[model samples]
Target: MRLRHKPWADQYMKDNNHILIQEPFEQKGCWKQLFDQQERPLHLEVGTGKGQFIAGMGEQHSEVNFVGIERVKSVIVGALKKVKAKETTNTRLAYVDAEDLRDLFVENEIDHIYLNFSDPWPKNRHEKRRLTYPTFLEQYQHILKDEGEITLKTDNLTFFEYSLVSFSKFGMTLQEVNLDLHETGDETNVPTEYEEKFSQKGQPIYRCRASFSK
Candidate 1:
């Protein structure tokens, strides 16, 4: 998508001086090398809006490799800018649809997956489009390692409730389900751009960490 008028478009275009790839799907293996170079577990964040959370995580946990996936080209470009500005070699951003995750990463490859403030798809007919839908969960199950965990954070209560039910139905174990993460006083839990904006309006953020069952 053209990002000419986006708020961060100009800054992104200027900051993306490091290696930025645009291949469709033929470079997954080469991307894997970038992760392997870190010699640590691989983590992925889907729907990285504005790139705050993943960028912070990448800076905080320099030992772990991070891969962020965004369907919107502009947003992906923005994320790449953050990685470049930080001069982070352990993080990579990919422009791909969430549904095509399995084609991008092999089974037992991913250590963790982050779904940060994903689209709720609130309408009944659009439920299937929700990132936490059963089909997408199954796709995550296929690509993630057997013990891989998914960390989900959202400001939509209905979506959070729906996600709990979906995880149960899929036999994934949910832990640390926080209905109000901000009140918990957990310094380690960094808030993303969307999370911060939504919470400032008195919206509660729902968070949970779930892992695939053996």
Candidate 2:
């Protein structure tokens, strides 16, 4: 499933000046600059859609390095365009699969991971494909620091409940589980493309933060 091979994705990639890093899993030390020369920790966003969330986070947290991983080339291009438009030097986008994150990042290298509105994989047969699956959790634990946190937000109730159970099974501590993100109408919560669409339909957004205990 090469995203660049799709017609729409090809145009989007060309329209945006996004340098596609194929097989990021193979380039283990390519992101050394994200941590080198700085004491600030590194943050990663899995399935960054259109880049709004990570770009906003980078703009607010200039001291931290943000890396956005998107499997879809079209989406990655849009995210890179946002980063470029904002002149955000603290952030970078990679066209990489979430399952390969462990291969790309070293152990205890990542400080935080943002899983915003990832694919729910609604079908029972596709449960393993869910971002919150135990297999993926293991990979996340391997890359994240002892105190690293994973912030998950989604509009799907089934996925949210499933993720809660999965986190508990993995011995991860869950915190700040919010069923409705807009209850307080906090301006700090930057909504992503999927979030915007789902929220417009009057759907309640579920959010929770989990941390690895080493």
How do the residues 1-214 of candidate 1 rate in per-residue lDDT, one tens digit apiece? 4565577654565455343545536655445666547568889888876788888898888888888878776677767767777877777776677457877877777889999988889999999989889889988998788878999999999999999999999999997699999988888887898889999999988899999888
How do the predictions measure up, each by TM-score? 0.89, 0.86
User: Could you tell me the lDDT of residue 164 within candidate 2?
Assistant: 94
In model 2, the Cα lDDT at residue 51 comes to 91
lDDT of all predictions? 0.80, 0.80
Which digits, one per residue and each the tens of the lDDT, describe model 2 over residues 1-214? 4544446665555454333344567556456454343567888888887898988888888888888888776667778778777876677777876556777888877889999988899999999999999989988998888989999999999999999999999999987789899786878887888888889999988899999765
State model 2's lDDT.
0.80
Clashes of each: 0, 0
